[model samples]
Target: MSDRKSNDEAESLLAGLMRFTGQVAGGTLEIARHTATMTAMFGEGWVRQMLLHSMEPERLEAMADAGHFLRDARETAGLSLKELADSLGLSDKSVLEEVERGDKIMPLELVLRSASLLARHDPVPFLIKFLRTYNPQLEQVLEQWGVMALPRQYERERRFVNLYRQHDALRGLSDDEHDRFIQYIDGAAQLVLDVMQKEKAANSPPTRVPKRPSPARKRTPRKRS
Candidate 1:
């Protein structure tokens, strides 16, 4: 009888220990899954930040040269400096000006916005060009991690891949040819902007004239005296 009682107590303790171990294992798995989800969502941004913090001096200068392309593209698109700066959510136009002048490192976010707006919503070419000029090391990092490939793949699969195709056609242009091509794009966009302005003026409501104030009587001064 005593021996039976001892066996019952031993079995209960063993069961409790096994249950506790299982619960701990389950909790660990849940934590790991949550970690992975967070990493997938934010890891690239974190990596980019890290890379930006460690940029080399020569790369920084090259970035200034790369930045002129944004100015060229913006002008080609017929966008005002303020318009592009506003689209990038900058508080001051000078911030964007500095970036274009290469007085500042172009933030990754700025690059994306500039590329998208200047390239007619196709950001791949500008992104590749800018990164190659601004930070080849970062470009290599993104390529190795498959980040760069994503945009190219997206461009290839997009319904408007014609833009991408057009860019590809210009890849072999001599420097002078490229400049002429840019001039052509700029002229076309400027023509469109002019047409749009004319249409806007034609369609706008006429300005309302303000009511003129009645003239004060000359006798008012004599009355006051």
Candidate 2:
């Protein structure tokens, strides 16, 4: 009876030890899995932040007051407040005054119209100054994209005059011929512009992130005879 009791006690102890070991192993595995999951999530977030930072345009910490620029442009154009208001089709100078004082937020359409009017007075200088004041990043991006070199007012006028002269000269040609000629000219111009843009982009600095390498697989040991 004593031997049986000792044997029973030993068996119970062994079973408890086994259960405790199993629980420890399972808990360790769960903790390891949780750690790995957390690490992966952290890595993903870090990568996303880096990507966004790299891709986002450089922005001003504080934007210039739109009204200030409008007021300056108006003054530079040598227009009186009343005249500016009248040109904009306002009944009175109250809106202009508010804008000039930076007390009221101007609408995008009004801002654009103001810029256009200023551009008529001084195209290149006004555009450069205005864009730099409002959004320097846009100016930089446009320059990088190779679209900043727009035709001047005189150049556009000359182009239209030349087009008219050419049309008159080609009046003797058939209508179909004239249409084909115009299409060819347009296609050729577009092709040239496309090529120039492609070259510009190619020359620009690359902004892509390097890819991460995959983990190597563990090799299984060969069975020995």
Candidate 3:
């Protein structure tokens, strides 16, 4: 009778263990299924945000002064202080300097000139940001274009490509002319790539030196029979 009672207790314990194992397995499967479903519903960026939500959020820089923005835009377009001043038809650099130093607000004509000169450098967004403070309607226009979320560099590149395609010179070109145009475009692309590579190399973090592997022991070759 005692032997039978021991066997019964062992069986009951084994059954409970099996049930607990099943519950754990089921829960793991359910979690995996839910994760897959979520991945399908939302993109990887959404999933990444969820995983990183507990970390410190990114801090956005305060909007730059309008004058500073213009200066930077001019520099990005490879224009010097004097060149920009001359382009604006100023006799001396004092006005440009004063505007850049935030000592004076830019006049409408100067602002328009700056925009035209900096067109290839994506000056619109910065201009919009600066103008919106005084003109509320600009905010609505920016919202319509979804420019707030788009990156400035990407927008600039997109605009450049679009303008290149729509240029009057590109329209109605013969095959030979088209080929020459493509070659010119290729040269321009190379120049842009070189500049970008130089900038990236300058700004990139220094690479860590890799550990040297241990030298292998010299082995004598065996003669084949």
Candidate 4:
């Protein structure tokens, strides 16, 4: 009688576990499908075709390059293996090796040191580099089509991607709301572009400096990279 009871309990537990697993799997798929539908609906205008026909290779390359740059930047900071570990409150010499090689997930402290030591005064450039490198084609496409078009384009894309990913939120919105969201994307892109272009032009180096009879030789703008 005890043996039979034990078997029944085991079967009951297994059934519960299977149901739990199925729910998790089902929920994840539903999320992905919703995301696809939203993007298909709003990845319109320039990236509509590109998004539908987007390639992943360029993205992979950009990420890899950014990772390599991060590693190199750390090395260039003159941080010794032991020193970086000390900075990270780690004592293991091999730890830095693993972090640099991507063999292990670098801890937050280590990443902070990397961002601080390598990126120094500004880490934003490194990020922009990653974006530019990882999705060169997309970057190129965005640059050519919408980059100069408006900052709103960037802003709209950012928000739309987020909203579309939030399954709970996306599921709640009606079709009309989705259309308004798409329109926001278009308007935002134009607004951002117009503002950025104005800022760029106003601050740009004067095409011709007022002629000074004994003018100092015109200084060249230093390249950031």
Candidate 5:
């Protein structure tokens, strides 16, 4: 290989290494912290990113989904990144630079606030971008670590699968027991769907309640000294 080609490859590899380490150091913020409480289900990983980062994945995928989202917000309000950044006391150029180089990482609350101020929408979508930036293995490993995610959950899942199979054991259940069995299965399914749907909706659009103005209060005239 030519020396120049070798140098270029080395540079790319180093950039990737730096980015990866940057991500790992940032992993607590990206994956472990954000994904707490519930582990992913679909065989999932930020569904949209999972596709592109998935390989042959997507420059075609959800990239436009969010940019378009942010763009509309920009146009609708006739605000430029600079204008919004100035409003927030930030350097207009830095904001654009981050967007162009795609290095924008901010806390969730700040992202939302910035999005609202800039786009008239929440900035939470940056979350998908964050998750997409991470390696999902970190989340799985962290979850499998420590007391909070004790193997007990996996064990319980295994046991539940076992019980569910036993619950289905008949050549077919007798009619009376069959109805109860169906109810059990149906109820279990509904419970799972309910949990998943709640989760999906939760992850979708954030529900923002604009701060309400405090109620009016009557003021008494000044008392004489």
Candidate 6:
């Protein structure tokens, strides 16, 4: 009788675990579909936010100076507090004022939108500075990844890859699952970088090649002769 009861309990637990795993798999698939449907810029922005959200809660909370970073980015973008608030669709500018003063955590959605809007000002660098300030663990990981020697252009991609690895580890993905998802993330990051490069090139002013001084009028020597 005891053996039968033990077997029944073990089977029930195993079934519950299977159900939970199925739910997680289904949810992941749905999220992947939705994210894949987003335009490149928006998709990359979403991925960046996902990385930000993966930070340890305690570290995130201690990020009191995040407001200062936001304020600096806003100033660099040449936006007034009210202007930024309006752009972010916030009805009250004072809320943003509070955020700028380091009194509040920036909402996740706001972080995503703000990062996109502040692209010209290099929001990724701002985020990296924030990480360096508040999260030593992430800095150590970045150091391990040889972040310093890499050119500035690839910083966003490297940071995203690192964060995606952290996200996978947190999710307890199997080795095979991690390998597959990481490849996808790498492709997405490359796509984003390509788009950004193209856009930058398109918006750049045409290079004006200096006209050679028409061989300085060879006839002048003939006239002297």
Candidate whose lDDT is highest: 1
lDDT of 5 by residue, 109-152 (tens): 54456565753433333344333334434334334434234434
Q: What TM-score, to 2 decimals, does candidate 3 have?
A: 0.35
Off by over 4 Å in 6: 1-62, 129-136, 148-225
Sort by TM-score, best first: what order?
1, 6, 3, 2, 4, 5
Roughly what TM-score does model 6 have, to 2 decimal places?
Answer: 0.36
Q: What are the candidates' C-alpha RMSDs?
A: 26.7, 28.3, 24.3, 28.6, 27.1, 24.9
Candidate 2 segments exceeding 4 Å error: 1-68, 102-105, 121-136, 146-225
**Ranking under lDDT, best-scoring first?**
1, 3, 6, 2, 4, 5
Alpha-carbon shift of residue 178 in model 1 (angstroms): 20
Candidate 4 per-residue lDDT over residues 84-190, each given as its tens digit: 66766776768666444433234334555566666666554444444333224434544543443444354455456555565667567789998887799799989
Candidate 1 wrongly placed segments (more than 4 Å): 1-57, 132-134, 138-225
Give the per-residue lDDT digits (tens) of candidate 6, residues 43-77: 66566466447645654544555676677667656
lDDT tens digits, residues 149-171, model 3?
Answer: 65456557655765765577677
lDDT of each: 0.66, 0.59, 0.63, 0.57, 0.52, 0.62
Query: How close to the true structure is residue 133 of candidate 4, measured as C-alpha lDDT?
Result: 34
lDDT of 2 by residue, 1-225 (tens): 999999998997678657645654564354446546755778745643443343323322212344555665676467999998888887999877865664433443565577677656445544443343333354554565455666334446644655656545676878998899889979998999999999999999999899999999999999999
Clashes of each: 0, 0, 0, 8, 2, 0
TM per candidate: 0.36, 0.30, 0.35, 0.29, 0.28, 0.36
Candidate 5: lDDT over CA atoms? 0.52
Flag regions of model 3 displaced more than 4 Å.
Answer: 1-64, 120-123, 136-141, 144-147, 151-225
Better of 3 and 4 by lDDT: 3
